[model samples]
Target: MYSALKAGFLALPYLSLGALAALDGHCPPLGPVLPAPTQPSKHEAVPAAAAALRGIIDQVTATYNGSAVAIGVKSIHESKLLFEYAHTPANKEKRGAQKVDSDTVFRLGSLTKVFPVLALLKLKDRGVRLDDPITKYVPELRGLKKQAREDSPVWVVDWDEVTLGALASHMAGIPSDLITDIAPFGNLSAYGYPPANTSRMLGCSGFFGTAPCNKTAVAFFEHYGQRPPAQVPFSSQTVYSNIAFPILSFAVEAITKRPFAEFVTNEIWKPSKMTRSFTTKPDDALGFIPPKDIWWDANLGFEGPEGGYFSTINDLHRFFDAILLNKLLPPAQTRKWLKPVTATSSTGLLIGQPWEIFRAENVTSDGRMIEIYTKTGDLIAYHSILVLIPDYDLVATMLLAGPEVSGSAMTLMLSRIIQTLLPAVEQAGKAEARAAYGGTYVDKATNSSITLSLSDDGPGFSISRYVIRGVDVPSTDPGSTLPPATPPRLDPPMRYRLYPATANSGRQTSWRAVGTRGTAAQVDKADAQIVWPMASCLTWAMMDRVTYNMGARDHFVFDVERGKVKGVEAVGYGVFMKKEC
Candidate 1:
């Protein structure tokens, strides 16, 4: 939840390239795009490189609880990294520190789903349309619709209607996860994080309890294709699902007439020269789950399509380089690699495919807005996040002990490294941007207030900050713990970073609620409860996706006359906040 930009303007990651130089040029070495326009080599970055590296290590180590945490930040235009920080100490010395470098291999969880998507993109380029149904290719599911008998216990809303596009976008009505109530895991179904592999996974509650062949990926799909789904799939959703990935992979495998692994090795991996990356195999690697005592090797087994690949930072950088360099796929097809599968989420976010598309609010130091075509993955032992930032020509990736890391923590760690490597800007261009929308505004109808100021940090031009109060805050529970004197406030305020939407939106910034503050004189989640009787009956997922307050409109509209600020709408919870400044 922490933004590295908040670490003041100076904190940056130091380049730990001691081991990077050892791994020389790749065969058919990539073109010069990655290393061009390079600044002075990392060593000459003024104020000494030691502080930056040490600052990065200290920041990460402060939160990283496990034995090994490796990170890499490199420019898409340059082969060398701006910074690479790896800390692994066995018994606190962190074992395998040397062995776990840019070249060390580790399981890349759901990221494995990317290759199948890549292959599908290639096929799409070759006349395989995306809108067609999977039945068009497999024929195994040609006649199956949401058919169910009177005695059927589960709703058959998802069968027969799933398309290749749906499968790829996770909109196929497949359950959010791949884990089943039956099999290798006993009671985890009580919670949602399902087992990564479906080999021993069996259906119990939703649809496939008595599914005859519940062992392999092929069998599970066959079982579902022949039957009805447990839940409804008509609505396009960005929910997580390992079920759709393997099915998509099967479709790719069928079309290519080659094993997924073999095809990728020849067409994707070998061409990119990612020699260190592998499938279901370890190359002198160690996965630390609970290094408090020992480690465990998390296996993908039949989840190969979902998460069975092992790769390193070096090969990962090279792989992205290949894509950017137009070695594996052309720029046009590669661009499709990051396109949104569906419109489930807001702009800048696309789910269910290999790379998670998030257009970040914060701009790079060089003033370019960032579109993060990134993916986060985890086995029982290893967790990682890899991203390709096309606009800045940057790629940052990292992997570490999973059990000891939270997804937010991992993201923050990477953000810390990324914040430093990005081109630095001395002062924000907030004054001009703010003149039209800055200062205090009050909503007389609701007795609410909003205070907007030029952000003191980050890229100044495109960012603003606001603290809202009164009706702007969600309603509190009828029976609350606090006294009447205490009221809800926006607390630390939220960052209103400007983003480009339509041509009009391009003139201003489009932002949403993203930051969080600590539990210090703040409105609590439990306190903001809905008092309606039917509110309790709403499903968790339903409430999560449905938007209540869009924080004004999708874009901020400012009313200005001559040089004076007038009013603003479609922001915060205010219907209209007239400028009072």
Candidate 2:
């Protein structure tokens, strides 16, 4: 969610008018609902509440080689400003002095998918069903088939399952390789390459390349349209690829009959009064001139539906405000956007339409459950974080420009800041509960698993499991006594450290697991069978069966029935589960 922070002249020297002006066109004005303070306070004094956060930013900037940073937060409850800050390097670059402020815009990278989601909802509002097939809108997909062989012609394959919903939710089963390219439009041999070599390179370049050049996308579809069906499943990467966005952009354009950027500006940005937001042109007033730096040129341009746009923190806060207020999209649609579409094990975060759903800890004044909606962006040399606390009506966004910023590192930093700052707003009054539920649990009936392990010898979490499938087994001679069972050789466990949730409370959970070592090569030779512990398996079994009590904070209870874990209830946080060896 975006925050609304108007640029105002302050008395402090550090808070100069130039800095304020730098923020003017970048920061959005406070929403109408925000209550004005009876008296304005000094802006220079660092609040004790945000001290830890400031320190964190300083440390991250120093560690990551960042040249500039900007941060903003807003309270969804009252639409009031929670905090905002911008910092720049003491040394300047040659082209122009890099000055960061609330208004300074940065390429949002993959965050562009959120806008397409909004567009999809808008289409839905106009009586378009997500279940409708792509062919329904773009007839080109009709009769489209994959080639059986390299020299074969395309043959039709059923695509009834490739629905609009699947495309938006990333279940459309479209291969990442299907993108078309629209680049190197002039002479083919301009780069001193043979015409044949240039043609060959162009044909295969679709599978590679950093950005989704339009020319490449077209070339890919032309040559591979007759190839075998796409095999990759829906994933976060699918949402970020240039291939996915052009198709989505085409759909939006076809539906609205307007340029994608223009439609977004009128339909979402302007109406929401996100004055600083733009998907097409960079804001010159905020110094977001194109081609000013290599990073900027490489990152920003014709905004794609997947991840091409720029905005200030305040503008993003406004965008979030629109979501919470049910202004841009209906409440039901917004909920759909935030709902978990799939489970992501790699990060242990639930994947929503375009958002990542995190079950946060340390929420309410009295410990209670809270949900976090988050998304991160990584471009050439920039990293950004956007997180929303639904229960607390809080939104936080950070953008850093540098040569070495990474999404993972930025997220780690953001998580730390939120954990430290959340308490000041409203403390989650739950006591430090017992650490009884700290160990791993397993369930044999469901054949599922989980493992909970600590990090830095400190409290943390990770997930470890093997997905079992039915397979043929060799039969042993009846007379042959089973060879003496031998214990399976184990390997050193691999650890996945958990980030504590930023919400008030619900499940303060974490995970860990053992790495694949001797399992693959020794499976056939091993005699003794490996099995997961009951508690861990039970948790996995109950995932879909149990009705989780978002309000319940009781002792860690694992309900097992018929040899499978049917339910789990844990106080403070859930126990970690590990897969059987």
Could you list the CA RMSD of all candidates, in the order they appear? 16.9, 18.9
Score each candidate by Cα lDDT: 0.52, 0.49
Writing each residue's lDDT as its tens digit, candidate 1 over 89-177 gives 44332443344567766668777777776777778655776677776776655433332343242534433466766777677775544
Clashes of each: 26, 53
Task: Report residue 236 deviation for candidate 2 (angstroms).
Answer: 13
Which candidate has the top score in lDDT? Answer: 1
What is the per-residue lDDT of model 2 for residues 1-581, given as tens digits with 9 covering 90 to 100? 01111111111111111111101111111111111121111122214557767776777676433366778866665455667777766543444435778878777867767787677678885677766776676666544453334322223324554666666665555654333333434455766744443442343221233453452253444454554544334433433233445566667777888988888889899878898776653634463322224555453223355666778887888888888789987776776676777665544466666676776535323222356778777665666778887544678898876655567767776777677666554321111111222345554444434344432122223333221111100111011122225422222322222222222122233211111122222322231232421111111111111122452211234443443333343322333233222
Segments in model 1 whose C-alpha atoms lie over 4 Å from true places = 1-54, 62-65, 91-98, 142-154, 157-160, 180-236, 283-296, 343-348, 363-369, 425-581
Off by over 4 Å in 2: 1-47, 63-66, 91-97, 143-159, 177-197, 200-212, 215-242, 281-292, 299-303, 360-370, 428-581
Model 2 root-mean-square deviation: 18.9
